[model samples]
Each structure stands twice: as structure tokens, then as C-alpha cells.
Target: MSTETTLIKQHVIDPEICIRCNTCEAICPVGAITHDSLNYVVKADVCNLCMDCISPCPTGSIDNWRMMPKAKAYSIEEQLKWDVLPAELSAEELAAAGAEVGAAQEEAQAAAQAAASSASAASTASASGFNSAAYGATIPPWSAAHAYTNLYGPKAAEKTITATVTGNLRVTEVGKQDGQQDYDTHHIVLDFGSMPFPVLEGQSIGIIPPGVDAKGKPHHARQYSIASPRNGERPGHNNLSLTIKRVLEDHDGQPVRGVGSNYMCDLQVGDKVQVIGPFGASFLMPNHPKSNIVMICTGTGSAPMRAMTEWRRRLRASGKFEGGKLMLFFGARTPAELPYFGPLNNLPKDFIDIEFAFSREVGKPKRYVQDALRDRAADIALQLKDPNTCFYVCGLKSMEEGVVMALRDIAQNAGLDWEAIGGALKKEGRLHLETY
Candidate 1:
């Protein structure tokens, strides 16, 4: 092949479908994936076609590829500015661009080989590191309902679906005047009047916050886990809900406004917003009768937990489904900080078993979700033994290690082979972790 016929297989993330979940960036072994406030972009020069970021992506957006002339491969800066993936180069266009068909075939085979080698090296390094993301599954549960995604996005005929704010209510308590920390979480509901948007439990939707950033470019959409069941937040309504916490302070106690969080939390009833995606297929709930669900989450992470629980609850309420055990291990700084505290307590023990961990209650020891999991190791061990049980963990990235470690210890103490069990969990799509 002549030098001009050299073709490069460029890996890319689909900005339209991408939720900016940061999973791809975190999993990329070579640090080739990066993001600005606008979009996540892959550095062409650094990427090794390793495929590490492909499976961990909940949105399926990281699997995109474009064949380009070696000299004309897209730059990270160009990819960052994309609202949608550029059109694929047809055979004629490729040839005109000086890439022969046979050369393209050779390039693809070479790319595959490179991907396999990089994947092998990544796997070996990952085995030595305690990466919880390694345990995440890419496939949906066998009994999961069909999920609809990317119905409206930048590349679609309709750029976005307009959702009207039906309701916005504060779910947590207001802080006192004496410099008390405010746990300001809002339960916002949006109604799509006539849009054909369908979603499932554990899925997410992207909200394009109004206005541009400091760079004067349009704000990229932000993904939020769906907090409502598949039926609807209000059954039979063409609507859904999200649990959003206003970020008045950063992790270091420094005040900073979260562009997306603030935009979502401040929405009033009847306000209009642009939305994209019903992203995520893997994190869905198991729909088979007697399929047990083990949900572990914290703060806003409870959004998808609520979706799954409510879905199961709705099914049980219908009296047609004989559901299995539903277990929830939820954590918060205090009882007051917990979302749906009143409603969660109101749930019948026969319907769902809930364990609440309060880390900052004045009179109580700082019990976290992992501590709560260990406290009920007997029950957790039983669930682990059951082939029908599926475990779901979602929370801050800091909580992932401890929660997974707790499960590992529980398995080991029960004389279970963790390697086999963990492998089975991933292979069978029984264990899911979503943290950022």
C-alpha cells in the first residue's frame, strides 16, 4: 500500500448520546479520554484502541469509530466541539481521500490486533489493581424490559424534546441560620406532552441546561438517573422525575454553583427545558417474577434505586406479580438528609427491606452504607448465594471500594469463591456499579 493509502481507524465518543458520565475517561488506561465542560473527547495520538472504556460506558456512546486518512485524523480539540459525530466517509469518499479499500481492510485488521493486545495488558494491570469498575456489567439483565434510547438528540431529526416542568418540590430539610449545612435536594417532575420518549428503571436522561458557559458555547447536557418507574412518576402520565441536589458547596466546603444541578433545582412549575436521551441499557431492573434486587446507594445515587423500587412496588401493588425480596442499603449524612425518608419508612417490610445508614447524626456513630452492609452480612450472604439475586451499587466514587470490599468479605466469610462469584456476577449481569 502506498503511504497516501494509509487509513486510520479513529475511536470516538458520540457526544449526542454521551451523558458525560465520566466512565470512559476513568476507565481509559492510557488517559486518552478527556472532557471539557462541553463534551468528552478522545486524544487520537494517545489512544491505543484499548477498548477498556467501551464496556464500562452505561450509555453505549464510547463505542463509536470513524475511518479517516492517517494525516487527517480528528484532533481532540475538534472532537470537543462536536455536537454529534461527523458523518461516516463512504467508500468513494475514502478512495478520494486516498485510502484504498484494501488498505482500509488491512487497517481494520491491524486495529483489531492492537485493541486485543492493549486489552490484554489492561486486564493484567487491572487484575493487580483493586478496580471496582472491573466488576461492572455491560449487558442488561435477562428479564429487563426493552429500553428506548437516543430518541431525540443532536443528530436526530428533532434536536431535542421539550419537557415542561410539572412539579418541583424540595425533598430534604432547610438548614438553620447558624451556618448549618443545607441538604437541598429537589424532586423535579417533567412532562413530555406529545413526545415519544420511553424509559425504564435505572436508566437516565440528559438535561441541556439553558444558556452558554464562560466559553460562550452552548451548555452540554448533563445526565441524571431516572427517579421514577417505567410507567411514570404518576402512573399513566407521560412524565418522569429526577432527584437533584443543589450544589452550594464543593467537597472542600468551598462554595461553587453546579451548572446543571443549579439549573435543575431552580426550575419552577410550567418551565420548559430541552432534554436528550433515555440513556443506559445495562442498569435496568430485573422483571422476572421472584427475581431479587439488592440496591445499595447514597444521596442522589438513590435516584435509580427509587426507580427500581417503585417499579417493583407498582408490580406488587397490581397483585399479578409474585416478586422476590427487595433490599435497599441507603446512606445519608443524617435522617434529615435522606431523600424520601418518610416514604421509605412507610414501605412495608414484606414489600422491601430498607437499611438506613446515618454518618453524621449527632448522637449516633458514623455508620456508612458499607458498615450497614457488614452489619447485615448474614442476609447479604444469603442473597449472594441465590442465583436469582442481582446487586446494584451506586454512589460517590469514594463509597465504591468500601461497598464492594464489604461484599467481597461477606463472600469470603461465607466460604464462597469470590473469584468465581465475582466473575459470574459480571458475566451474568448480576452486579452493577455506577459511581462518579
Candidate 2:
């Protein structure tokens, strides 16, 4: 490909919709995608329009494309400074940049053909390195109830909604007195009085912290999974809950506090906060009769899992729906570190099959969520073949790959073709992964 001679489709990230989840950056095969603390940008010089990063992105921010002469494509430096995407180049500008009108059209067609070929190749790849889009569901499950999304936030014409902090309680048992590490996690409730902010299980919302960043720019929003059921945290009210962990250090071990998490955790009862989105359109629970749910999660990833579980519990209590099996495989460093440890135990054993894996418990061998899944492989394998069964995985980013691999192994060992089953899982919206 000539660097400056041809016209091409340029990939760009929409900073407005991006939650800075790092999904696009992680999945990009070429080193074309990079991000700072504030933005994720694609280097036009490096991107081949492979589309590997598109479907993995929870938000469709990475799906944007603009046509321009290759030489006129936005540089990485320019993209990093962008708060919003620049307008597409005009036809006259494209012609003036390099090629004439006829030649530009020909080149653009060639580029489109090349992108199509790359996409075809991606679909036929081996099951071991499968395309995430092939096996990741974008639609809510068939029986999922109608969910209200984007009632507030950037996409909404109205200003962001405000919610009162109804409650904030530390969920994790951390401290020297407890003989555990000094890490803290909080379960928070936000009440949206008289606001029509309806949400389903497995959805997330963004919180815009009350101040500017160190650069004196307005702080961007941070997304957190909704931990309460659709009805409300306390049932039949306009409220929701969030599971937030205080971020005292960056991923690089630097002592930089997280802007959103700290602000949320430090909230007092009756304090109001700006909120946006009931974000995710997918990753929802199936509402059909006899539908089984298998939830796997670690850390705060348990937020959405808790929502689904609680909703199922509520349904069971109402005696209106004949629910199917509900299985949970949760992992943490210790029982003390697990959010909702005591409350989870209080759930009736017959209602949900719950297993806890503790990796760092003293005098116990390390066990991950995958380990628990393997131990219960036969049950999970049966579920994999069942059309009514749905699998949800959330939590730490590190757990995503392992959990998927374990699912693959289970399917194959059960005498099923992994590729076919994986495709069906996605096609039927039976598998959902939401890791950060």
C-alpha cells in the first residue's frame, strides 16, 4: 500500500461514547490502537481496517470510519488531542489532497474490497483463535424483557440525570483487625426519584465525577455495572445499586487515585451525583420459562451477576414464574474479599447453585473461577448443549480468556464441535462477556 497515493477508509474512535475500557486496544492485532488516560486513538498509518477490535468493544465507538486520502488521514498525534471526531473531508479536498476524482473512487473501491476479504478470512479462522464477533452476542436474549436505555447522558438531548445517594456501605471485610489486606469495596445505592431511568440486569451506567481532572479539563465519566434488579434495589422503586472498588493505584503501580470510584465511594447519604446511560443493549438475562443461567465472575464483575441473581430470586419469591437452574461460579482472594459474601450465603441453596473459589485463602490451594467450572464440567457441558441455557462472564479482565477457554474445553469434551456450539451460543445470544 502506498502511503500517500491512495484514498482509504480511516478508522476513528468516538471519545464521546468511549468508556476507556481498553477493549479495542487489547484486541487490535496490529499495534495501531493506543490510549492514554483520557483517550483511545487509532493510528491511521498502521490500521489495515482489519475490524478485529470492532465487535469486542462494548460501546460501538470503534466502529466509526471516514473516507479520506491516505496522506490526509488524521495522525495519531492529532487524534490524541481530539475531544470529538473531525468532520469528514470534502470531495474537493480529497481530490486536491492527492488523486483526481476518478482515481480516488477506484482506490476507495479497492480498499473496500480489501476490507471485505479481511473480514471473510477472519470468519474462517480456527476455533482456538476465534473471532470474538462470531461468538459474542450483540442482541439481548430472545426472552429478555424490553429494556430502557440512554434515558440520560451524552446521547440524550436532555442534560444528564441526577440521582441521590441513598446508601453507601463497605461490602468487603478489609482491615488489620480482620487480618486481611487493606483493600475496600463499597455497595452503593442511587435513587432516581420520579425519573424514568429503567434498566435491565447486566446493564451499566456512567458516573461523571464532580470536578475536573489534573489537567483542569472536565472529568470524563466512568462506567459501572448496575447491581440492582430492574424493579429497584428495594423493589418497586426508582433506584439502583453499584459495586465500586476504591482505586488507590494505577495499573502500573503508580499512586494515582481513580477519579470516578473514589468520588462514588466517598458519597454520603442524600448527596446528588450526575449519571448517564443505562448503557449496554446486550448482556441481559433471558426471561423465558425454564431458562437456565450460568454466571461466572470475580471482584466487582459480580455486580451484574448479582443483579441477575437477585431478579431471579425475586421472581422465585413472587411465585409467578417457574424459573430454571441458576448457577454461579465466583472467585476472589478470600471469602472476606468477596462482595456480598454474607448475603450470598443467605440465599436459599436450592434456589441457586453457588460455588466460591478463593485463590489466596490461607492453607488452601489456589483456585480460580475456571477451576470451579471444570470441577462442575458435566453440568456445564449439559447446559452448553441446551438451548435454554445462557452463560454470563464478568469481572477482572484477566479472567475473560481463561473462562472462555474453559467453556470451549467443556463443549469439546461433551462430544460437541466447539466451533459450531460457540457460533450457536453467540447467534442465540446465549453467551455474554463483560470484563473491564
Candidate 3:
């Protein structure tokens, strides 16, 4: 078979930086993105360079592109197997590989135009649809601190930083042996010792599980949200905390253990674990004074919320800063299932306003986080209009649409312009959604 001479700019995701958060997979209009338990990849034939998945990515990994011969473009299969992106081929190398290097620009532009034309008609309806992922901002707020990412990564990662486990405790009550939902989450503390792994409030760390997959390759890194303030999990120590749920069952109600979550939950205090990244940029909390935060979450999604709240609490305790209102809406099946239930309540009422929704109580009516949002429609409407108030929603994938729709409904009922409000949220980095 003969190969084509024209070169095409291939859109690829950097697996090293990607957190497997599912944002890109959700936002890609043409279904170009897909993922397994390992990595997320873009299909060369399906991807049209539509660029819709670029901005909503929290880690900025989806913005990478490589010029390659169209006939020999990287396939989704090849990409999913990569631990790191292949180095770019030079012009001479491209020509030697049966591509016309000089025609790269012309072919790239043509592909882009065709993609735009095909996606144009659907864009209008997509804009009108209520996609929470669409409203997710790709940048941090104006007052957010400088977050450092990709400081250390794969490729010579054997020499990368490793942290010692200092503390491991169960935060939630023990569930029944047969899954009665009593919160099987653990609070794990990792001490970097003398090494520097600077992470922000919303940033995540990639832990390489000490095992291989069914394919016999090393298990890819799993991302977990940091659950402590940036200063340290314990004050003044070189440590951080992670809230990890022991995955005993798959989403299908079958007995299937999660490789990464189980490995993390079972670590001992003296164990050493390989770590990489301090991934994420756009999901960071604002550092300026008097900036409000509204957090809505379910289950272990409360990890990042804990980080931001603790940081603000520390600042308030120091008496050096005057922080604004902090409101939290946390949902769980029962009180015992909620991680940090005791600590979250122990926070001063004057310092924070919290709402809890329990849907599976024995006798009470079912209530979800969205129902709580509607119950506080008036207050939420006010916050919706406040520029200083940043709204963050993190939880299961199923909760994303309902929560975003709740926000839209609140805006509409208040006689506010939802179009303008939603647009500003994306443009000004006021809304962040991180559902797995």
C-alpha cells in the first residue's frame, strides 16, 4: 500500500499530566476521546481538531499536538499504551517517513477548517444545552496562587521523589462486612521528608501502585486529591494528607477491587511509595482576602474541599486575614458515610455555613445536593451574582448534570440572565467542576 505525502497535525493528550478526570472525554463533541483503566487517548480518525476539549481541561494536558504523516498517524490503541508522548519527528525525519514536510501547514489548516465547518451547525444547540462540563473554567481565579505542575514526572521516574507514609487512620466509621455504607474512607499522611513536592489547594498527586496490570505492564499512576492545607497535613511538617475510599465494589454492584484506591488504602506507616506530579492548575483556590467559596460534593470528592476550608480556617485562626463566607453542601447516604463528618461539624458555625443532605435514611424523605440547592435558592442566587464568590462542584459523575442544572434554575428563577451568568462563569474562572 502507498502512503500519503501530506502531513497532519495530530491532537494528542499528554498521559503524564492527565489526571484521568474525564473532563476531556465529556467535552469532546465528536467522541474523539476515550479511556480505559490506564490512560485517556484521542482517536486520530475520529478527532477533527475541533478544539472543543482544549479549554475545559483542568490540567492543560489536552492541548498537545504533534505533526505526523496522515497515513501513519498515531492510533488510539498506540496512545493508550504510552507512558509518555513520543518525541516530535524533525522535518527531515518526517520526509523520510513518507510525509511531505513542506505541506504540513497547508494540510493542517485544511483539516482545521473542515472540522470547524462540520461542528458549526451543532455548536448552537450545544451552547444552549445545560452541560456542567461546559461551564467549567480552564483557568484559576484572578487571586489564585502560582501553582507549580509537572515539576517531576515519568521518564527517569525511578529517580523521582518518594514519600514515606507517616500516618494512616480511618476517618469514617466502619461499614458492615457486606457493604452497609458506614464510610470506608481512610486519611493517609505522606511525608516528603526533605524533598520538595509543592502542591496547591486543588492540586493532585499521582501515586504509582506497586504492581502490574493484567497486561503485565506497570500500573499507571492514579490521581488523588490532597486533603490537607498546603502548609502541611500536620502544621509545620513536611507532609500532606489524602482521603481515599476503599473501592470494594464496581459501579455495577459487582465485586471488583480498584487497583490504585486499594493499594493506597492498604499502605502502612513505614511504607515508601513512588510519587509524581502535583498535577492540576485551574482548580486552585483563590488566595486573595474576602473571597467566598461555595462547595458542593458527595463521598470522597470532599478531599479538595477539605484542603480549601482548612487553609481558610488556618488563615482565620492566625488573625492575619479576614476571609469571606464559606458555605458547604455535602451529601451522603447517612451521617456515618460522610468523611470528616465529626471535624466538619466541629468547625465554628460563625466561620462556615454547612448543609448536609442524606438521601437514604431509614425513615426520612430522600434529599440530594440539588434539592438542597433549590431549598436555598435565594441565597444561591445572591452568590451566583457575586464576582468574588467561586462555586466548586466535585463528586460522582452522575451528580454533575443535576448540580449544574440546579445552578441554572436558580439563576433563571431569580430573573437573572443565565446566559450572561454562565458565560461569565466560564470566562472569569468562577465555576470549577471536578467529577470523576
Residue-pair clash count for candidate 3: 0
lDDT of 2 by residue, 1-436 (tens): 3567577778899988787876677556555799888789998877777776775566678889888777777888888888888887778777667656576667777876796668545554544665443455656789998866766755432569999999999999764313432578999999999978999998888888877877787777799999999999999999999999888777766666788988998999999998888777778999896999999999899999999999988888888978999999999988888999999999999999999999989999999999999999999999998999999988876787788888889889889899889878877889987776
Model 1: lDDT equals 0.84
Whole-model lDDT per candidate: 0.84, 0.83, 0.84
State each candidate's clash count: 0, 0, 0
Positional deviation of residue 431's Cα in model 2 after best superposition, in angstroms: 1.1
User: Across residues 116-151, which tens digit of lDDT does each residue of candidate 3 receive?
Assistant: 777533432444465566677778999999988877
Checking candidate 1 for backbone clashes, the offending pairs are: none
TM-score of each: 0.87, 0.92, 0.90
The window of 10 residues in a row where model 1 has the poorest summed lDDT is 119-128
Error of 3 at 116 (Å): 7.3
Once fitted onto the true fold, the runs of candidate 3 whose alpha carbons sit more than 4 angstroms away are 1-6, 15-19, 55-61, 69-72, 81-100, 113-128, 177-183
List runs of model 2 lying over 4 Å from the truth.
1-3, 26-32, 45-60, 101-106, 123-134, 155-158, 176-181
